[model samples]
Target chain A: MDRFRVAAVVTLRRSIADVQGTTVEQALHALGFRAIENVRIGKYVEMEIRAASAEEAHRHAEQACQRLLANPVIEDYQILAVTPAVAKEVP
Target chain B: MKFGIVVFPGSNCDWDVYWAVRAGLGEEAEFLWHKEESIPGDIDCVVLPGGFSYGDYLRSGAIARFAPIMGAVARFARAGGLVLGICNGFQILCEAGLLPGAFLRNRQLRFVCRSVFVRVERSDTPFTNLLQPGAVLRLPVAHGEGNYYAEPSVLRELERRGQILFRYCDAAGQLTEDANPNGSVANIAGVLSPEGNVLGMMPHPERACETLLGGTDGLTVFESLQRHCTMAVATSAVL
Candidate 1:
C-alpha cells in the first residue's frame, strides 16, 4: 500500500450566509485594507491515507468529506491535493 | 413506557434527562452508553441530550452522530420508535440525517446561555402532542452554535408538512426578530421528522421539566412521550 498525504478543503456554500466571514471582512476594512471582497473563511483538513495510488487516495478523501469531514447541506468540499509519501529507512 | 438516554463521551446532560424522567416525571429510564451497539428491546423512547460531544471539535454533534449506538437509533427511528434530541443532540440529529437543516455559529458568535420564549408551531408530533398549537413555552437555551439553516425548498416542504414544531417568539406569540435568541431561520427553535417520530430542538426541555428549576413548560414534552409510548403499546397489544 502506498502512503498518500491528502488535503480536504471545505467551505460554506455560496448560497449560505457566511456570518463569520462577514465579521472578518469588517475587521480587515477597519485595519485600512479595503481591497478584500467576499472574504470568506473555510476549513482545511489534511491527513495521510494508505492507498494504491493518488487517484485512490483522492477518492478516499472525497468520501471522508462527504460522510463526515464536511456537512453537505450548507458546505462544499473538495480534495485539494494528494501526493504519495516517501518511505523512511529503519534505523 | 421505558425511556433510554444515549450518553456520549461529553454528554453532561444525561443525568439531567435521567432525573427529569425518573424523579421529576416518575417514569422508567436508563442510560444507553454511546458504545452500546443496540438499544434494549423494551426501550420505548430514546433521548440524545445536550453537551459538547468530542469537545464539539469539528462541529457540534458531527462526530457523535457516528457513535456505535446511532446505527441502532436510526433503525429504531425508521421503525417508528420515538427519538428526541435536545440542544447538542439536535445538532447530532441533523448531522445524522435524522433531521433536516444545519446549525451554524450564532450570529453574534457568542455562547448564549439563558431562558427564552418559544411558541408551539405544531402539536401533532410525539414531542409536542400534549401541547396546543400556538401555545407559548418558556425554555432555556445554552449553546454557541444554534442558528438553524436549510435550503429554501426544504424549508418550504417542512412548512407544508407541518414539521416545524416550535419557534422563538414573544410572550404574546408574535414572531419577532428581537425575540429570536439565536437568529434561527424563521425563528425556528425545533423541528420534527416527516414521520413525526423524531424531534430535534436547540432548547433544553429537560432543564425546564420542574417548577423549582424555573418553569414547567417542558414537562409537557416528557409527558407527551409517555402518553404516546403507552398508547402505542396498548394499541399493539389490542391488535
Candidate 2:
C-alpha cells in the first residue's frame, strides 16, 4: 500500500457570479493593477489517502469531490494531483 | 399536528421552531437528533430549522446533508409528508437533492440580518394555504448565502409549474431591486418541491411568529400547516 497526497480545487461554474472574486478584482484595480480581469476565486483542498495504487487514490479523491467537496449544481471540481507521499530522512 | 424538528450539530433555531409550534401554536412538537435513523411514526410535519449546521463546513449544508437523520428526512419527504426547510435548513435541502437550485454568497458579499417583505405568489401549498392570494408578509431573513440560483431551464420549470411560493418585494409588494435583500434570482424568497409537499425558503418564519419578536405575520405559516393536517385527518376519517 502507498500513502497518496491528493489536492483538489473547487470553483464556481463560470455561469455563476462570483461576488467575492469581483470584490477582490475591484480592490486590485484600485491598487493600480488595472490590467487584471475575470478574477474568480475558488477553494483548494488537500488530503492524504492510503490506497493500493495511484489510480485507486485518484478515483477515491474524485468520488470525494463529487459527493462532498463540490456542489455540481453551482460548482465544479478538479483533482489537481495524486502523488505518493515521500518518506522523511532519519537524523 | 405533530411536528418533528431536526437538530443538526450546529442547529441554533431548533428551539425557536419548537417554541413556535408548542408554546405559540399550542401543538405537539419534539426535537429529533441528527443521528436518529428514523422519524417517529406519528409526526405529521418535519422542520429543518436555520443555523450553521456542521459549522457550514466545505459549504453551507454540504456536510450536514449526510447526517444519519437526513436519510429518514429524505424518505419522509418522498412519502408525501410535509417538510419545511428554513434558512440554513434550505441550504441543507438543496445540498441533499431534496430541492433544486443552490445558494451563492449574498451578491453584496455581506451577511444580511433584517426584516423584509415577501409576496406570496401562490396560496395552494400547505405552507401558505392560510394566506390570501398575493398576500405580502413581513418576515425576517438572516444569512450570508441566500442568493438562490439555478440553471435557466430549471428556473423556467419552477415558474411554469407554479413552484415558486414567495418573492422579495416592497412594503406595497412591488418586486423592486431594493426589496431583494440578497439578490436572489427573480427575487425568489421561497419555493415548493415539484411534488408540492416540501418547501424551502431563506427567511426565518419561525423568528417572526410572536408579536414581541417584532411581528406575528409568521404565525400564518404554522397555522396553515395545522389547517392542512386537520383537514387531512378529517378527510381520512370520512374515507
Candidate 3:
C-alpha cells in the first residue's frame, strides 16, 4: 500500500454558543490583551496511512470521518495528500 | 409508540437512527432538531444519535451539549423519559452533565472503527432490561475521542450505582486492553443515570440493528427499552 497523509480538521459549530471560548475571551479581556478576537478552538490533526493508492487512502479517510472523526451535524472536513516521505533503502 | 430522534447539524447517524427505530418499533417516529425549544408532544422516548456535531471541534459533543434542544431533553430525562445517546451522542450527554464522566481523545489519538465485543454489565437499567448481565454482544464502535474519564469519586459512585451498563470485552469475555480500543478509563462502553432513564454509549446500536448489514446485537438495546417501557405503562395502569 502506498503511504498517504490524512488530517481530520474538526471545528466548533457556528450555530452553537461556545462557553469555553467565551471564558477564554473574557480571560483575555481581563488580562487587558484585547487585540485577539473570536478565538475558536478546533482540532487540526495529521496522520499517515498506508494505502495502495491515493484514491484508496482518501476513501478510508472519508470513512474514518463519516464513522468517527467528523460530526456530520456541525463539523466539516476536507481530505488532502501531502508530499510523501522518501522510501528508505531496504537492507 | 412515538420516538424522538434529535438532529444536530453534524449528526451523521440521524437518518440511521430513525430507520433503526422504525424498523424495531414500527413507524410513528419524529425528528427534533437541536435548535428546537421542545420535544414534540407525547414522545415516548428520545435518541441522541452519533456523529461529529459541531465538527467535534473543541471536543466531541462539547459544543452540541449546549444546544437548545438539549434543554428539552434534559427536562425530559429529569421527568424519567428514556434517552439513549450513541457515539457522539454519548459524548454530548457527558458534556451536558446529564450523565457522569467525560470522553477524552483516544490515548493513541487515532480514529478507531471495528466490531468489538461488549459485555452487558447490568440488566437493571431501562436500556439493558432485556439482556442478562455478562451477556456478550458484538457491536460496532467508531470514534476518536472515546476514552472515558471521571473523578475517582464519580468512578466509585458509578460502580456503586450500577450505572456502567456496557463494558468492552474480548471473545473470552475477559476485560483486557485488546477489548479497550480507545483506552477508556474502565473499559467503559456505556452508562446510565440513577433513574436508568438516560443511557449513553460510544458504540452505535442503530448501526447494529440489521444483521444483513453486519450485526443485529444492537437491536436488543431498543427491544429492551420497548419491553420495559411497555411493562412500566401496563403496571402503572393497573395501579
True contacts kept of each: 0.73, 0.87, 0.00
**DockQ of model 3, rounded to 2 decimals:** 0.02
lDDT of 3 by residue, A1-91 (tens): 5787776676656653444566778899899989978876566768777787777777887887665566544456666554354555799
For model 3 the local lDDT of residue A14 reads 68
| Candidate 1 lDDT, B44-143, residue by residue in tens | 8999999999899888999999999999999999998889999999999999999999999998889999999999987777787788999999999999
- Candidate 3 displacement at residue A11 in angstroms: 17
* DockQ (CA atoms), all models: 0.80, 0.88, 0.02
The model with the greatest DockQ is 2
Quick one: best lDDT, which candidate?
2
In candidate 2, how many Å is residue A57 off? 1.2
The order of the candidates by DockQ, greatest first, is 2, 1, 3
Off by over 4 Å in 2: A87-91
Worst 10 residues of 2 chain B by lDDT: B125-134
Model 1, residue pairs in steric clash:
none
Q: What C-alpha lDDT does candidate 2 achieve relative to the native structure?
A: 0.94
Candidate 3 residues lying further than 4 Å off, grouped into runs, are: A1-91
Worst 10 residues of 2 chain A by lDDT: A81-90
Q: How good is the docking of model 2, as DockQ?
A: 0.88
